[model samples]
Target chain A: MQIRKFHVYLTLVMFSTGFLMASSIELTQSTKKSRENENELQQEMSLNERIIAEREKNRSLEIQSLDRQRDISKIEEELAKHETDAAGLLANLEEARMLAGTVPAEGAGIVVTLRDNPSSNSQNVIQNIVHEQDIWRVVNELYAAGAEGVSVNDQRLVTSSSIRCVGPTVIVNGVKSAAPFVIKAVGDPDTLEAALHLPGGVVDVFDGFIKIESGKKENIQLPAFLGDAKVGKSVS
Target chain B: MGQNRKITFILTTISAIIGVMLAVQLQSNLHPLQSESRSITELRKVLLQEQEKSKVLLADISKQEQLLSQYQESLDSVDSIGVMKEELSRAQKQAGLASVSGKGIIIQIEQDPILNEQWDAENLPLPDPSNLVLDVDLRWLTNELLANGAQVLSINNNRLLSNSSIRNVGEKIQVDTKTIRMPYEIKALGNPDTLISSMKLEGLEEFFRSVNMKVTIEERENLVIPAFNGTKHIQHMKPIKAKGDS
Candidate 1:
C-alpha cells in the first residue's frame, strides 16, 4: 500500500509537470504570433499614413497648377489688348502722315453759305429762321463733291457725329452751330464747281430762298482732324 | 460521484472545443467582408481621381473655345479693314487725285424756309416744325453718297459709318449720344460729280423741295471731314481658333 501511494504521487507530479511544459509551449507560440501581428499592424499603419500624405500633396499641386494657368491666361489677355492698342496707334500715325502729304497746301473750292435770307418785309428773321435739316443737305453736297473734311462753324467733323435740327437751331455733333453756314471743301476746282451746278443739286434748290455762291480761290486750307476715331470690338 | 465528475469534465472540454470552432469560423467570415470594404475604398479613390481629370479637361475645352472665338473675330476685322482699304484705293484712283487723297465736298442745308411773298400777312400760313428739314434727310443723303461710292461721310465733322445713328429725341437729335443742332455740314469723300448726281436723284431732290427747305450743294477740291467725338466701348467676342490646334 505504501509503495502504491508513493508511485501515485510520482505519477501525479509527472503529469502536472507535463501539463505545465505543454502550457508554456502554447503560451510562447501565442506570444510569438502576437508579436508578428503587432509588426504587421505597424507596417500597415505607416503605409496608410504615407498614402494620405501623398494624396494631400497631389491635391495641393493640382490647385497650384490651376492657379498658374489662370495667371497665364490673364497675362495673355493683357498682352493681346496691348497689341491691339499698339496696332491702332500705328494705323492712326500712318493715317496722319498720309493726310499731311495728301491734303492740298493751298487751294479753295466753292464755299456755300446758307442762312435765313431775311424777308424784306419781316422784321423778325429769327422767328422764321432755317431748320437744321436744310443745312445737312448743303453739307452732304459738299461732301459728295469729294470734300476731304468739313466743320460746322468751329466744330470739326469726326468719325461718330450727326447733324440734326433741335428746335430752331441745327445741332452739329451735339453742339449748336448757327448760320450764315460756311461749308469749305478742297478738291478739283472745276469738277467741284460743276457737281454743285447739277440741275436738281442742292445749290439749284437754294434758288431764291437762300444765297448760294461758288468761286475759285487761290488757296483753301482745311483743318486737320482734332479728335480720335473710335475703334469698336472686333467681330468675326 | 465519479460519473458526475466525468460528465462535468466532458462537458467543459466540449464547450472549449466549440468556442475554438466558433472563433475560427468568425475570423474566416470577417476576412472577406474586410477585403470587400478595402475594395470599395480603392474604388472611391479611383473615382475621385477620374473626377479631377475630367474637371481639368473641361477647363481646357473652355480655354480652347475662347481662343477660337477671338481668332475668328480678328479674322473678320482684318477682312473688313481690307475691304475698306480696297474701296478707298479704288475711289482714289477714280478721282484722278494722287493716291485718292484729297478734300471732299461740303453740303449745307438750311432747315427754315423764307416766308412766301405771295401770301399776305393776314393769310400767313404757319409752318409745322416736322415739315422742316430733319436729320433723317441728312442720313439719306449720306447713304446716297456712300452708295455712289463715297468712302467716308461726316455730318458736322462727325464721320458717318454704317453703324452711325442720326436719331431725334424730344425735339433734340442725338448723334452717338451727342446732340447736334442745324444747319448741319455734311462732308463726304468721293467723286464730286457722282456724289452730286446721286443726291440729285428723284427721292432726295423732291424730298428737300417738299419740305421747302433750302439746300446748298458746293464741291470743294479739298475737304477734310473731322473724326467722331465720343467714346468707343471695348467688346470681347469669341475666338476663331483653338490654342495649339493646327
Candidate 2:
C-alpha cells in the first residue's frame, strides 16, 4: 500500500508540472500579441493628432496670406486715389495758366542799367569799383518798387535764380555779369520807374554815386520766362 | 492531482492573453505619437512661409505710401498757382492796362570816384560793385516791386514761380538751371509816374552817390515781356487718384 501511494503521488506531480508549463507558454504568447495590437492603436491615434494639428496650422497660414493680400489691395487703392488727385490739380493749374494768358506779356515799364564806372583817376585806379552789394541793393529796391519780372544781362529771373559775388564779378544764374547791368520790366512804365526813382528807390539811392538816367520809351520788350518751379512734398 | 494541474494551466493561459493585449496597445500608442511629430513639423514650415509673405507685403505698402505723399505735394503747388493766376487776371482787367513794347531807359550805376580815392592805400584791393548781381538782389527787387503794386515781374526770360530756389554753387549762381549775366532788366506793369516818383527816397539817392553808381530809370508806355521758357516737371507728393466720370 505504501508503494502504491508513492507512485500515485509521483504521477500527480508530473502531470501538474507539465500542464503548468504549457499554460505559462500560452499566456506569454497571448500577452505579446495583445501588446502589439495596443501599440498599433496608439500609433494610429498619434497619426490622427498630427493630421489635426497640420490642418490647423495650414488654416492659420491661409488666413494670414489672405490678410496680406487684402492689405496690398488697400494700399493699391490709396495709390490710385493719390494719382487721381494729382491729375486734378494739374488740370486746374493748366486752366489758370490759360486764363492768365501768356506770362510776361506786354506792359508799360522802365529799364534800369547799373554798371561799374570806369576809373577817371588813373589806369591802375581799380581801387574802388561797383560792389556786388550795390547790385543786390538796387535789385532789392526794384522789388520793393513793385517791379514784376527782372533779368540781368538777358538772364531771366526765376524762382530758382541765384545772384552771388565771385571775385569782382556778380554771378547771376551761373553767368558772370559785369556793369552796366541792364534791368527791363513790362508794367506801368511811369509807376514802375517811379518806384525805382523814389527817395529810397534802388536807382535813387545810387543816383549821385552812379550814373542814373531816367527816361521813357514808347514800348519795352520783356524777355520770355524760363525755368521750372519745383514744389516740395509736404510732411504733414 | 489532475484537477490541480488543469487549474494551473488555465491561469498561465490567461496571463499570456493579458500580456499580448498590453503589448499591442503600447505599439498603437507609439505610432500615433510619431505621426503627430511629423504633422507638427509640416505645420511649422507652413507658418514660416506665411511669415515671409507677410514681410514682403509690408515692404510693398511702405513704398506705396511714399509715392502717395509725393503726388499730394504736386497737387498743392498746382492749386496755389491757379489762385495766383486768377487774381492776376482780375487785376489786369481792372487796371485797363495796354500792351507795351519798345526801347526803355538805360539807367547806369557806378561806384563813387571820390569814395575810391578816399580808401586808404594800405587796403590795396577794393570791393568791386559789379559783383552784386546775385539771387538776393534779384529776389529783393522782385519782392519790392510786388510790394509796390507792380505786377507781371519776369527775370530775363524766366518767369518767377512761387516755388523757385536760388542757390549758389561755388562762385556761380544758378536760377532755374539757367545762367544769367550782369545788368539785370526788371519789368513790371503799373503807372510810371507813381512808380518813378516813389523811387526818389533820400537814402536811395544818397546811397547811390556814395557808391558812385549810376541808376538810370526810363519809362516806356509800350513794353513786351517774354514768356517763360523753362520746362514744367510733373510733381506730386501723393499718388494721384482717378477722377470721377468727366
Candidate 3:
C-alpha cells in the first residue's frame, strides 16, 4: 500500500510540474505579443494625435478665410456705392452746362420779315411809316408766342439787348439796323406760325402800313449768348 | 492517506493558476484600445503644432484689418469733393445763363383787318393810326401773359429779361434796344395748359375781341428758351457781402 501511495504522489508532482511548464511557456508568448501590441498602439496614438492637430489647424484656417471673404465683400459693396454717387454728380454737371448760354440751341421755330409799305402815301409820311413803336409791338407779340430764342437781322437778341430809334434810323443792341428786319425764333414752328397769322394779329394790323411776311421753319438754330454770363450775380 | 492528501493539494494549485490565465486573456481581447495608453510626449507635440498654427493665423488677420482701414480713409476724402461740385451746378441753373427747354405756349397778334380792306379805314384821308397795333396794345398783352404764368418770354427773336424795355419811338416800337416789326410772334415757356387757360380769361379775351384784333394761341410740346446773351453789367446793383467775406 505504501509503494502504491508513493507512486501516486510522484505522478501528481510530475503532472503539476508539466502543467507549470506549459503555463510558463504560454505566459512568455503572451508577454511578447503584448509588448509588440503596445508598440503598435504607441505608433497609432501618435498618428491619431497628428490627425487631431491637423484637423484643428484646418478648421481655424477655414474660419479665417470665411471672415476675410466677408470683409472683402463689404468693401466691394462700399466701392460700388461711391462709384454710383460719382456718376450722378457728373450728370448734374452736364445739365448745368447746357443751361448757360455758352451753348447753341436748336429747335422748330418761325421767321418773320418786315418791310416798309411800298404803296403808302408820300404825304403825311409819319402816319404811313413803320415807327419804332410798330417794331416794339411786333416783338412783344413774338414773346407771347413762346419763342425760346430770338434773333433780328442776324443779331442775336439777349435779355439785356435793347431796341430804340435814333431819328429815322433804328439802333438795336448799340448798333444800327435798317428796315426789312428778319426775326428768327426757336420754338414750336407750328405754334409760332399760327400765333402770327391771327385774324387781326400784328401781321394784319400792319397790312396797309408795312409789308409783313412770316412762316414756320421746321428747324432753326440760335447762336449761343455771346455776352458774359453773371453766374454769381445774386439778387440779394 | 497523508501521501494521498499531499497529491490532491498539488493538483488543486495547478488548476487555480490555469483559471486565472484564461480570465486575463479574455479581458485583454475584449477591449484592446482601453488597455493601451498614449505617451506624454506625443500629446505635448500635438499641442505645440496647434498653437503655432494659431499664431500664424492671428498675424494674417491683423494685416488684413490694416488694409481695410486704409480703404475707409480714402472714401472720406472723395465725399468732400462731391459736395463742392453740387453747389456750383445749382448756381449756374438759377442765373438764366443756361439754355432751357420745356412745354409752353405761343401767341401772335396782328392789326385791324378793316385797314386792309380800305387803306383809309377810319375817316376820309390817309391810313389811320388807330387801325394799327399800338405800343400800348403790346405792353398790355405782355402784362397779361406774365399774369398767366409765362416763365420765360421772348418777343420776335429778342429774349426779354428783368432789364428789358418795350417803348415807342415815333411811330415804331422798340424792344430791349432793338426795333421790332409787325406780325409779332411771342414765345412763352411755362405749363401749356395753365398758360393757355389763364390767357383766355374773360376781360382779356373780350377786350381783344372788341378791338377787332386777331390773336392766335397754340401749345408746344418742346420749346427751347435761349440763355441771356447780353453782358452782365451790374451798374446800379451790387451783391451783398456775406458775413464771412473780407
Share of true Cα-Cα contacts across chains kept by each model: 0.01, 0.02, 0.08
Chain B TM-score, candidate 1?
0.52
Candidate 2 local lDDT, B1-246, one digit each (tens)? 776666667556755665675566556545533323344445555445455544543453454344344444445645534443443343223221213233322223444455566664556566564444455545555554443445444455454442333434345555556665544456654556655565564233454554344456678765454444554332211111222100
Off by over 4 Å in 2: A1-104, A119-128, A234-236, B1-246
Q: Over the stretch B115-158, how does candidate 3's per-residue lDDT look in tens digits? A: 34564554456545665566686666665565455666777866
Q: Report the number of the highest-lDDT candidate.
A: 3
**Ranking of all candidate structures by their DockQ, best first:** 3, 2, 1
The residue ranges of model 1 lying beyond 4 angstroms of the native Cα positions read A1-236, B1-101, B112-124, B236-246
For each of the candidates, the C-alpha root-mean-square deviation to the true structure, in angstroms, is: 29.9, 30.0, 37.5
Worst 10 residues of 3 chain B by lDDT: B237-246
* Residue B208, model 2, lDDT: 50
Alpha carbon lDDT of residue B45, candidate 2?
Answer: 53
DockQ (CA atoms), all models: 0.02, 0.02, 0.04
Output the better candidate (1/2) by TM-score: 1
Choose 1 or 3, whichever is better by lDDT. 3
> If ranked by lDDT, best first, what sequence of candidates would result?
3, 1, 2
lDDT digits (tens) for residues A69-158 of candidate 2: 344334434433666643444444432322222123234556777665564343443423566556555554554444445566665554
- The B-chain TM-score of model 3 reads 0.54
